[model samples]
Target: MQGRSIPAPNDWAAQFWSPIVGAEAQATRETVAMYDMTALKRLEVTGPGAAAFLERLCTGKVAKSVGSVTYTLLLDHDGGIRSDITVARLARDRFQVGANGNLDLDWFSRHLPADGTVQVRDITPGTCCIGLWGPLARKVLQPLTDEDFSNEGLKYFRAKRAYIGSVPVTAMRLSYVGELGWELYTTADQGLKLWDTLWQAAKPLGGVIAGRGAFNSLRLEKGYRSFGTDMTYEHDPYEAGVGFAVKLDKDDFIGKAALQRRKSEVRRKLTCLTIDDPHSVVMGKEPVYDGGRAVGYVTSAAYGYTIGKGIAYAWLPAELAVPGTPVRIGYFDQRIEAVVAEEPLFDPTMSRLRG
Candidate 1:
C-alpha cells in the first residue's frame, strides 16, 4: 500500500476525562456505556492490493473476509512485537487499522509500496470513537440502528456499517472489559451526534459514562494485555502468553521463523496472580518472590472488582507459572502474599463476551 503523510492528532484524547461525570463502578457492573477512544490512532488501507500488502506486514492473517476484525501484531525482524493492532476488513478493498500511536504509521511509511495499487491514509484526526459496553449494550444500541444487533446477527469480532441518529458509523462487536459491547466509530463531524444519541438511549437502560480508570480495572479482570506494558519488542508472543494468536503455518511473514523456534523453548511464561490483601493493591512493576529470592516482576495490575482481588500479570519460570503457585509481591515496606490464579478471573469460559 502507498502510505500518506501522517495527520496531526486531534485533541479529543485530552478531553476524554473532562466532560465525564458519574460513578465509574456503574459503568463496569451494568448497562450500556461509552469510553473515549480517540487517543488511539486509526488508519485506512485501501485499493486493489490492500489485503495482500497487509498480509505481508502483520503476524496475523490480514486478508480476512470482509466485515471481520483481526487482532494482530506488527513484529520486528527478530519476532519481537513492535505494535499490537486491530484490523477491520471493512470491504473488499478497504481495511482499518487502529493502535495506540504512530508506530503503525511509521511501519507503513517504511514498507508500503510507492505504486498506487494499495494505499494507506491516517484517519485519526477525522474519526472519533466511543464504545458501548456491558449487558445492556445491545439493547440500548438496537433502537438507534436498523441492522439486526441480536447475538445471531452481530457476533463477536465482526464489523458492519450503519447509522445512528443521522450519523453514519461503523460498529464492531468487541470486548475489552469482558462484556457484550460494540465500539461505534464515526467521522469527527458526526461525533457529537453519535455520542449524544447513544447516551440518550443508554440512560433508561442503566448505562453510564466511563473513563480510563474503569477500563483499567475491567481489562485486568479479563486478563487483557496492554501492548507496551505487558507485551513488547522485548517479549515474544510465547513468553507473553499470547502465542495462540500467531499462525506460524501461514505463508511466510515477519517474525514467522524466529517465533517458530521460540515456541516450545520458552523459559519464562506470562500468567496471572492475585493478592490476598485487598488494601495493598499493586499497581504493577512490583518484584515477585519465590523462596525469598526475586524471581520475576509484574507487568500490569489493577483491583478486579468482580473477582475482588488485586489482579496482576508477571512473567515467571514456566514451572512457577501455574495455578495456586504461591508467591510474594514486594512493594516498599510490604511483601504481599499471592497465588498464581487462572486468568480471565471474571469469565474463564469467555461466554459473557460472546453473549
Candidate 2:
C-alpha cells in the first residue's frame, strides 16, 4: 500500500513497484527488500472457544502460548487441503490468522458453533502489512526502533508488539522468502508513516522496493508452495510436500482420520522440476511428460534468478518424483527437458532464515 504512488504495472492487483524483477530478486537475497503484502488477507478470531475451534479446524498444533505462530493447514473431511495458514496466538483466547482469501473467511464462518463461543472478523480492510526481508533487515530496522530486533530478542516464528518511530506495529518474525525479517502489521491510518520510516532507513543500506514478480521467483527458489496454485482442496498435505505441518499425534482435527489412512498411501506428489536449458522459460499450467507419456501438469513456474534456472512445480506420479528423474515440459510448440530436484534449492539448511 505504501508503494501505491510508484508508476508500475500491477501483478495480482498489487503494484510491481520495481520494474527490474531480477534486480529486485537479487536485492532481497543480498540486502533488504521491502514488499507490500497488504493485499494478503488477515483475520482475527477470539472468544472462549477460539483455541478449541481452531484446533478442530487446523491440522497443526494451534493452542500454544501467546506470541507463538503455527503454520497449519485447513483440510476438508477427505484429507484434502483447503488452505494453508499461519495462526498467531495473541492471547489465551485470541488469535490473528494469516489466511488465503475471502474463501477462508467464508469457510471459518460456516463452521462456527451456534453457542456464540467463537467470533471471526475480517481485519484486512482496516490493517496493512509490510514484509521487510534480507540479511541486512535487522541492521536497518534495529536503528529505528527501541525494540530488540536481534535473533535472540525476537526469534523466528514469534510475534510481539513494537514501535517504529511513532508508528505502533505488531511485528511477526517470519518470511515467505526464507530471509531473516519481520512482517510488520499496523493500522491503515499509519501505513504511510510506517512505509516512510522503513524506506528512509533501508535506502542507504541498498534496500529496494520489490514486487510480486520477484516474490514469486524468490519463493519458488525456496520451494515455498502457493495455495490455490501449487495445491488446492483436491490435494492432501503429504502429496503437497507439507506433511511436516500436520501433527497427527495432536488432538483430532477435521481430516485426521482421513489423513491417518492417506499418509502411508501417497500415490502422487507435487514434484520440483528444473529446466535443463537455463534460457528456456515456461509459465505455469504447462503439461509435463515422462518420456512422451503425459503424466502430469505444472502448477506453478518461474525463472529462479538466484539459481540461474527456470523452476517449475508439477504434480507427478510418486515414482517419477524422485530426484534426477528426467522429464519434459510442453511449452507451446517446444518440449523442454527438465529433471526432478530436491526442494528449497536455496538455503535448504535455512541458515539465512535463522541468521
**TM-score of each predicted structure versus truth:** 0.91, 0.94
Clashes of each: 0, 0
Q: Candidate 2, residues 215-317: lDDT per residue as tens digits? A: 9989999999999999999999999999999999998899999999999999999999997565565678889998879999999887777777778999999
How accurate locally, in lDDT, is each candidate? Answer: 0.81, 0.91
| Candidate 1: tens digits of C-alpha lDDT, residues 131-190 | 888888888888888888888988999999888878999998987888898888999999
Stretches of candidate 1 exceeding 4 Å from the true structure:
1-23
Residue runs of model 2 more than 4 Å from their true location after superposition: 1-19
Ten contiguous residues minimizing lDDT sum, candidate 1: 1-10
TM-score of 2: 0.94
- The weakest ten consecutive residues by lDDT in model 2 span 1-10
Model 2 C-alpha RMSD to native:
4.7
Clashing residue pairs for model 1: none
